[model samples]
Target: MTSTQEEKAEIILNLINKRKTVPKGVIYHDYNDADGSIKMQELQFLISLLEERGLIILKGASRDPILTITEEGLNFPGFEKQREIDAIAERKKEEREKLEIKNLKGSVFQVKYWWVILLLNSIISFLIAYLTKS
Candidate 1:
């Protein structure tokens, strides 16, 4: 599937973070097609944006540039926000599971004491009938 510009930027940042320093050619090759066509312009634009933002340092020659992630880049706001969202989702999932387990326990209790419920219903019905008759 196609990725948004933000997503692509995040991917680039993640790669740089993992490696500390990465070759521009490595990233370019990843975006290149088997036919030898490359999305160099788009990649260069992203690199420039990152450099401008001080998230990364671009060095070496234009043809074989290198990228090094900055400390600020490691704690990128977008990544932080994503981590928070993931944590919220995980908590919601845990809550749902707990609720499901609670409901299941209630259901099991009802099932286990079905005979008592039936006996109580019978007594109540008999009492109601006798009261109405009187």
Candidate 2:
């Protein structure tokens, strides 16, 4: 029986996770086929697959990193959780930003209330002086 997309993705993720370092600088030259360099392409597709799951990350072209498994990404209970975990993380970040924006929009800027604060301080000072004089 042919493996599902999930199965293929899981195999790749497990392979990378077992490595001490996922070769962040560049994929090994051997990983690619001599012909069309299709191995690199396949690895990239696999990377995208895991990223979709939220289990790995590849950032900065300068580094040309391979995605690594995340500890919290275990929730992708399925075999291909790495791909799911990335999406989950992204959605969670988006939600947090949304909630934060809502909170920010609900309140007025604190610096703008400086004049009101000054007035309150002036009133307290005036009352203290009056009591001392009395």
Candidate 3:
């Protein structure tokens, strides 16, 4: 299975965590054919994001970068915790959307029911008047 962006990031993070310091070439070479290894562009993107988040630092030139996890990153929760946090956030977002949909459906149903009631009342009144006159 293709690893997700998050999963790929976690994999890279774990590698850095274990080695403390890893050269750029080693990282690329190690994942050259591995299942979870990301593409070059994707790896760069992940590295940028991680650097921005203070999770990892890249030292040296663009072509020959060395990766080292930050102190905060080293102390960060395990990969499972990262996945759990992501899952919880996604679940909460879905739940909020579901609630909004339910409320919208309830409002629509109420309006439709009100219109039906009004039509029924009008018809009943008309029938009673006609019968009384006859």
Candidate 4:
């Protein structure tokens, strides 16, 4: 099966984490196809994404960049506490939105019910007056 981008990134991160700093050739070798074709573009994209996320630093010339894992990258895959906190916050936000929607539905129902009650009362009063006058 093909690896997802996140999975591929994790592999790269792990590789860098082991040595702290690795040459680009190391990564190219690791991702080389069975036929010996190098996946240069795919590897570059992954590296760029990791760099953008501040997980790794890419240095040296464009031809053979060096990859260095940051402290954040070391902590990224195993940062359970931060992930838990974020998940909890997201759940709370979803619950609050659900409650707000329920409250809005209740308010609309009340308004419609009030209008129906007023109409019924008016009809009853008009019928009562007509019967009394006759």
Which one is best on lDDT? Answer: 3
Q: What is the lDDT of every predicted structure here?
A: 0.80, 0.62, 0.81, 0.80
Q: Cα miss at 109, model 3 (Å)?
A: 42
lDDT of candidate 2 over 36-115, digit per residue (tens)? 34355566676777777578766556347755677644444665454578789999999999999987865555566778
* Deviation from native of the Cα of residue 111 in model 4, angstroms: 27
Better of 2 and 4 by lDDT: 4
Between candidates 2 and 3, the one scoring higher on TM-score is 3
- Candidate 3 residues 1-134, lDDT tens each? 13576677777787778788898677766666565455788888877877887999999888979999999888878556877999999999999999999999999998879979899999999999999999
* TM-score for each candidate, following the candidate numbering: 0.50, 0.40, 0.53, 0.55
Candidate 2 residue 16 C-alpha distance from true site, Å: 1.8
lDDT tens per residue, model 4, 1-134? 13466667677778778889999888778655322444778778888988998999988998899999888888885334556878999999999999999999999998879978899999999999999999
TM-score rank order: 4, 3, 1, 2
What residue pairs are clashing in model 1?
none
lDDT of 4: 0.80
Cα displacement (Å) at residue 104, model 3: 35
- Per-candidate count of clashing residue pairs (backbone under 3 Å): 0, 11, 0, 0
Q: Single out the weakest 10-residue window by summed lDDT for candidate 2.
A: 29-38
Model 3 poorest 10 in a row by lDDT: 29-38
